[model samples]
Target: MSAIFNFQSLLTVILLLICTCAYIRSLAPSILDRNKTGLLGIFWKCARIESRLELQ
Candidate 1:
């Protein structure tokens, strides 16, 4: 029925949004660091680099 189809479409859209949000969340820290400075910035940079290295 039309309702079933609508439900399916809604589920697909919700899944896509969840995936996109997760991807963006993962990149947020690095993106925020583009204008970083001082010790906090240095710590974040170090943590980011270590994370990337660990990922491999």
Candidate 2:
């Protein structure tokens, strides 16, 4: 019973992380499309990481 409870908690955390990454990916294109500054470099790094991950 304890094992089952722990597994459920772990699964919940994994799902939450997946959702958060998907949300960030959805926002990635907008940053690249516009000529916005400040956060631009951060977004570019994320986009590069995302492309590398896709290639892998």
Model 1 segments more than 4 A misplaced: 1-5, 29-56
Candidate 1 has its poorest 10 consecutive residues by lDDT at 16-25
Q: Give the lDDT of residue 54 in candidate 2.
A: 65
Q: RMSD of model 2, in Å?
A: 7.3
| TM per candidate | 0.42, 0.41
Q: In terms of lDDT, which candidate is strongest?
A: 2
Q: In candidate 2, what residue range of length 10 has the lowest lDDT sum?
A: 35-44
User: Candidate 2's residue-wise lDDT over 1-56, tens digit each?
Assistant: 45346988777765555555545657776645463356655554545555666678
lDDT of 1 by residue, 1-56 (tens): 45337988777765555454445436785553553587545444544555565569
- State the local distance difference test value for candidate 1: 0.55
